[model samples]
Target: MLMKATVSGSDVKTGGIALHNLQKRYGNAIAVDDVSLSISPGEFISLLGPSGSGKTTSLMMIAGFETPDSGQILLDGKDITRLPPHRRELGVIFQNYALFPHMTVAENVAYPLRMRRMAKVEVEKRVGHILDQVHLGALASRYPHQMSGGQQQRVAIARALVFDPPVLLLDEPLGALDKKLREHLRNEIKTLHKEVGKTMIYVTHDQDEALSMSDRVAVMHEGRIRQVSAPKDIYRRPADLFVAGFVGEVNLVPVKLKSGTVHGPASENLPAPEWQEADRDATLCVRPEHLHLKTSPPGSSGGLQGRISGMTFVGDATIFQFRSETGLELLSKVLNVLPETMPGVGDPCVASWAANDATILTE
Candidate 1:
């Protein structure tokens, strides 16, 4: 049987979250600076950025945990900027499990229902349902201390969903788990979000996590929403220098734009009619995956030559560090399979990519 996909707050909901010129400040530092964005209904959106970028602060404002210094926050057509935390009807999952060590899994999941004065029978029914949803029904009687980290996370998710809130807010929910466990639970959390069908707003600094899980990603920087788009668009076509560098591994080569083509320090040229006619200063941005490495001498089409500075095996792909004669430090990825003739460290090699492979950025 085909598996049914889980639902996030996006399922039952038909509207989205809108921030209109939202701003928050503390003395001289601006936490969120006139930021605005529209989150589609049911869209899995992530606030992705490094620490102190105001992503968490913006989320707190939406949850009514922090008051915005200016602007409006709207859910659907209603203004919810001033609503209290309890009145906002949002399910919040934090980095910490925040479960009571003394309470059994069932009790922890049932806590939310009890807070609303739900009857004993109704609470049990809801708790049972959520435990089954999180695949912890058999371990319902076990306490937090008795379960693994992943299981504890499931209990937290269960508690968040048991009340059936309108929105689910996850604040780096997988931050504390080990690498393998984090990867496993990432899919699980995504699965639970879909099953619950609640509109969700996830926050994290991990780029891979955001890319793999979110339907759309909001790249935040210096108290602003720098770019908001689908995961592919965010990675393939970044809006600025920050987005390009922050989203993935890439090498940037300074170049000059003349008559619609980009001229790098080396002989390789880029196709850009607009850039050729544009300003003199430009940059060529290329991802690691697009680079081609060769140990032989160049043919009619000569590529940039460089010395292999280092090589590291990362299982699936090997990372090569190259220093071009023109002073460009570049990193390229090669497949792990043999007969591809991987470049050894300190070997002189040629690096080349298609003309269309490089992105021209004026900044």
Candidate 2:
């Protein structure tokens, strides 16, 4: 259970951030290019991309650790582009838990308050309250060396919260933990966000973290944001080819659009993009899960006829690789229940999906 901490006044309604044309460059190389985004108060937004996509660099600029070459950083409509990190009054958590080795959990959590010259009694009270809130009350006396990675991360979170800042910036806070622990901590962090209601700007390269935890995800690529949308929209209705291909495992099929129809390998007269021009080339994006597989006659008419070229059982789901009669490869994912019903390798199958399940990408 996490406790809510006040910032300024009870009715302040703080934690809105806006980045306007923020750009950063390293000599001739552009790290961030014309990036702009507005986050609502108490919204949990994730900057998601592969490494060097400028997610971390954008976070650093917001934290005041890195100055932008051009543009502005505004918190609640006030420009803080040139403010120092400590003066920005923002809570920041790094991938590495940057706790002092010699400090105990309680002392570490109290460091922010101490640095502010808070009275000793108030610091001790806040430390005790936050430790208990993070379920670290019993480990208050444990030094960093005596704690596990997960516990150390909790200490970092508690420290960040102890000061009760309006906004929290997390840069891959769980990147150092093992998979199981990372998943567990992800839930805890989500719960913390709800309990505290602080605006959270999370930077992560992990799609699962962004998809599962964020209210909206800003997908970045090549130092620019490709798309900003809710997780479902980001996955289902990606804005472009880059966003479709980056967010998930997708099968991109080259096709031609003519007279309100789509023509592709082993497929014709399929759905066409409502806004796309006719008689042009486009790509079809479909996720493996959307493609359904069923044993069918060699010459199926309703769907593409294919042979199961390969099959892989991945715990909860099985992945089936299908080779269409036209030699186009497609993948289908099916739940593992009733394994006897699944098609075997080399079996004739029909792969199909609803028209709406596929997206047409012009680029």
**lDDT (C-alpha, whole model) for all candidates:** 0.82, 0.87
Indicate the worst ten consecutive residues by lDDT in candidate 1.
1-10
Candidate 1 regions exceeding 4 Å error are 1-15, 271-276, 298-301
Model 1, range 278-358, lDDT digits (tens) per residue? Answer: 447877778898887777543434577777998888999888898887878999987764735776787777888776677
- Per-residue alpha-carbon lDDT of model 2 for 228-285, expressed as tens digits? 8899999998888888878988878888887677888655565435534688888988
Query: lDDT of model 1 at residue 151?
Result: 94
Clashing pairs in 2: none
* Each prediction's TM-score versus the true structure: 0.91, 0.94
